[model samples]
Target chain A: MLGDIKTVAQGTFDRYFKMKELYVILILCILNIAALSRYDVLTLNMGKEFMIDGALAILTVVALITSMAVIFEKSRELREKTAHFIITKPYGRSSYIWGKFIGISFLAIFNMAILTAGALIVFKLTSYENVMANNLATEFIYAALLITAEAIVLTALGLFFSMFLSDTITALMVLVFFILGHSFYILEKMSSESSKIFGWVSDILPNLHNLDLKSAITDNITITQDVLGYGLLYAVLYAVAFVAASSMIFSRKDIS
Target chain B: MYAIETHNLYKTFGWFLSKRKVHALNNLELKVPENVIYGFLGPNGAGKTTTIKILLGLVIPSKGHSKIFGIDTHDPDTRNHVGFLPENPKFYPYLTASDFLDFCGKIIHMDAMERSKRKDELLEKVGLTHAANQKMEGFSRGMLQRMGIAQALISDPDLIILDEPITGLDPMGRADIKRILLELREEGKTIFFSSHILSDVERMCDMVGIINHGQLIEHGSLDELRSDIGVNIHTTGVASNALMEGEKLCDYITLKNGEAIFTLTNKSDKDTVMKFISDNGGSVIRSVKLQEELEAFFLRRIQNDEKAREEEVN
Candidate 1:
């Protein structure tokens, strides 16, 4: 069973990298970096703030697109019966679901790492002041980690949606979840006086806003290790729940 | 123990929509002994594929149960000894043939060394060694079918279940698959396959089950079914309708070139027909029961089914 999981995860990750969409998303990330560099130059040294924001924006968009593509590709495989080769083997359905979850999560982290390097390169070549090089590097790295953590959570949600829903609807729902999750704080505040259901909804949805480290760079606030650790734990927990739900549904699916 | 067994296996689909059900497999009872090729024959939508799916645990039976090697199919371990090739197999298009086989080996928990060795052997057996490095996206249908067979054998499973394994192959391709299946049978592997190519089934299958309308219509050893078709008496020396009229047991008579061929209506008439032919100055040229060809039997079964269905409809 462990071997089965490793094979599926490795196979899925390898296949994900081979996709043409990954390269397209990489090129788009590079173009976004170029645009950010141009904006930094036009502002005549804006002090590393917009550059971090630009980097996070690029990471979020690329992560969401790639995650959706990966999940949809897998969903299509199941519907098209290409999965017959794997599902008919000795492995359990849970292994297949977990393999896909881990595989796409790996891709999510890898994609963010590549774009983080690109964003760092962009910031290095561009002019910025009011912050030391080490400080900027540290801040940029934490921001990348936060973005990746959130992306991991969203990827799990996308995979869960893909199991029972069509690709278009799954993509749309994941997008909606991302947007709503980012505004979870605002929903919590507005619903404080409204109904108890709204409060539950806010708590149930992933608090993606908590993982956003961009404001730390802009507001000159230091993000402690404890806060980052908490955010990572939250992401991990949500991802686990979503994957468990997906595996439960997939294990019993007729798939005919 | 039987290699494959099903007790009153039943499957129904689309039960929620319009309150109608499509009975794919209805009260199917099957038993296949070990180390023999069992050919499953049926027309389109005759539940052959559905039965295979149930055995593979792809679809659960609505009622009854199936077992592989005496182990319930619901257990994942039961599939460890079974290899299945679905009809018109669809594999991941991006992986090369070797990589795909490696994945299959991994699915069955084979170690790297054993996987590599088994992969090479199966690739050779399926005539896919030359295209071992070629991606499946460019493969022709025949090549994909061959690759499907190779992947199915990657685990070296004891029980092989194939659904329409020879659908889209040239004569040479068909011959290659037939050879592989026979060789596997020789190795004491249990091989069960469904095919529209009755000639291949006739030549390769040790036992066969004919299914119609989601029911087993006829099943037994090939020779047993063949021998049930009755006897034909070919006589020389005189061509006459007198043999048919005199024998009172001959159902039909055909005369050509100073020879008469009589189809006896009953097995009991064989001795009487022979005696009468000898007594009437006719020499029995060849007298033997004609074995029913698979094609003929299949067509007759299907025609009978259609007639019965029509009568009920009327």
Candidate 2:
């Protein structure tokens, strides 16, 4: 089963890497981050805050794009029946779901790393003294890690929804989930004032806010070890739950 | 034990909005023995592909069960000894032919050494060696079909199931697939395939099953399914008067250049026809039993099944 998962993961990663459109999007994203980091309007005094904000925002977009790429590819696999080649092999359906999730998550991480690296380079190249005095490198790394957690959750969510829904519907659901995940506090607030259903929804929705450390970076507030550890734990739990649900749904699915 | 077996397998697809159900398979009982080429024959939407999918555990049956090599198909290990090629197979277009096979090998858990060896052997066998490194996106339909076959054999499975394996192939490609299937059978592999090419099935299958309306209309050896319809007797030197007597014994007779041809719908009439021709001083030339072709037999069975269903409905 491990071998099957590895094969599918490697295959999925290779397939996504070979898509010229994906590369084009990635390149555009890197350039966008580069330009945003070196924007002249943000003076050197505010350079760290501005660069980190823009980079994290761009990273979110990259994560969303990577998630959508996964959804679209899985959708095409089912629509074109290419998945038959893999699903009919001597491997469990759970392995397929895990493989896809892992593969696309790796791509998401790669994209995030490249964008983060590009943003950091531009920040250092444009504002050398600011970097030395403030020591924003660690903060940027923390911000990237938080975004990576968010990307992992989104990728798993995308894979889960794509298993049972059409491409358009899956994308819409993932997008809605991402929005709701980040605004879970709104749902929590609504629950206190309005209805218990909102409370239930908030509980079920992943609290992506926990993983949002951009403010921490921009404000130069040190993110405690406890907070970072909890955030990572939350992301892992949410991602695992989504993947487990996906596996259960996919195991009984008719690949016809 | 049968290489493939299904007991009262039933499946139905339901439209969620309309609440209308399409019965794809109804009490489908099939038994395919090991080490033989079994041809599954059916018209479009006759449940051939559905049955194959069920056997591969790609689709779940609404009722009943199927087993491969005596193990339930729902078990993933059941596929350890089986390889399948779907109809109009689609692959990861970005992958080269060689890479695609290697991926397939890994799915079946073949180690790197075994995968490498099998990859080369299958590519050469399928005549795709030249395009080993070329992306499958650039392949023609025939090349893709060959690639499909190669992947199906990458595991060196005990049972190989293919749906419409020869649909997009030229005559030579078809012949090559036929040779491969035959060779696999010789090596103790059971092959179950469905194809619209009845002539190819007729040439390769040791046993066949014809299905329609989600039911098995015919299942048996080719010879058993294609019973001798009648016999034709050719004779020479039969006097015109004797020819008339021979015609009375036979279903019909034709004469040309002092030669007589007798066609009998009944096999028993052949001996009588021959004896009468001998008594009439006519020399027998040859006698040939006329048997139905698989295509004709398949059509006749399906038509009869449809007629029966109509009568039942009426």
Candidate 3:
């Protein structure tokens, strides 16, 4: 079973790299981050902070789009009956889903690393006094890790929705969840003021705030190791729940 | 145990919201023995593909059950020795032919050394050695079909199931597939395939099952199903009046260029026709037994089944 998962993961990873659009998006995002850091166009005299923020935002978008592309390709495989080749093999459906999650998550991490490197290069070449004096390097790395966690969770959510929904519908659901997940605090407040159902909604929705370290980094609030650890744990638990549900649903599906 | 067996397998499509339910398979009972090429024949939407899907555990049977090598199909291990090529097989577009085969090899738990050896052997066998590194998206339909066959054999499985394996091939390609299948049979591998090409099936299949309207209309060996339907007698040189007497004993009689031909629906009538021709001073040239062609037999069985269903409805 582990061998099958590895095969599937390797296949998915190779296929994604072959996609020209993924590289196109990656290059565009890197250039955007570089331009933001070199020129203070977004905010005057605070180009370094703006670059970091813009880079993280761009990473989130890139992760969402890339993950959506994977889901859409998966939908095409199901629609075109290409998945029959893998599903009919001597492996369980859970292995296939896990392999897909791992493959896409690896791609997400790679994308984040490239973008982070591009941002750091621009920071060094420009020799931003504030960036060097404030020692924001560690915080930037922590923020990037947080974004990676969010990207992985979103990939899992996309995979779960894609089990029964079309690609378009799955993307819509993932986008909605992404929005609701970030606003989980507001939902919690509403539950105290009004209907108790909002409490359930907040509980059901993944708390993206747990994985959001951008504000802390930007506002100069200290993000300790324990917070980062808890965030990673939350991401893993949420992603696993989604992956387990996807596997259960996929195992029972009629792939005709 | 049979290599593949389905007992009272049933499947239906649509639900309460739909006005009608499409019964894809109704009590389909099939038994395919090991080490033989069994051809599954049916018209479009006649449940041939559905049955194959069920055997591969792609589709759950609404009722009844299916087993592979005496183990339930729901068990993933049942497919360990089963290789399948779906109709119009599709693969990861970005994967090369060799890479795709390697991935399949890994799925069956073949180590790197065994996978590499088996991958090369299969690529050469399927005539895709030249396209080993080429991406599958650029391949023609015939090339994809060959790749499909290669992947199905990468595991050196005991049972190979293919759906419409020869649909997109040229004559030479079809002949190559026939040769491969025959060679596999010689190695004691059970092959079950469905195809519209009855001529190829007739040449290769040791046994066949004909299905119509989700039911098995005919099932037996090719020779048994194509049993001798009649006999033909050829003779000459007696006079047109003598031909008339011989014609009375036969169901069909034709004369061209002073030679008379008689076709009898019963093999027993051949002796009587020969005796009559000889008594009338005509010499018998030859007698040949006429057997049904597989194509004709398949069509006749399906037509009879349709007629029976119509009568029942009426």
How many residue pairs collide in each prediction? 0, 0, 0
List DockQ, one per candidate, in order. Answer: 0.64, 0.71, 0.71
Predictions in order: chain A TM-score: 0.88, 0.88, 0.90
| RMSD for each of the candidates | 4.2, 3.7, 3.6
DockQ of 1: 0.64
List runs of model 1 lying over 4 Å from the truth. Answer: A40-48, A129-134, A190-200, B15-18, B226-288, B306-314
lDDT of 3: 0.84
lDDT of 3 by residue, B80-172 (tens): 788888887678888889888888888778888998999999999888999999999999887888888888888788999999999878998
Docking class of 2: medium
Candidate 3 residue A28 C-alpha distance from true site, Å: 1.3
Q: Model 1 over residues B193-309: C-alpha lDDT tens digits?
A: 999999999999999998887888888898877646677778886436466565565777677677788787555567777777777778878867767788998898789888998
- Mark the 10 consecutive residues where model 1 chain A has the least summed lDDT: A125-134
Task: Tell me the tens digit of each residue's lDDT in model 2 across B88-145.
Answer: 8678888899888888888877789999999999998888899999999999888888
What level of docking quality does candidate 1 show?
A: medium
lDDT scores in order: 0.82, 0.84, 0.84
TM-score of each: 0.87, 0.89, 0.89
True contacts kept of 2: 0.90
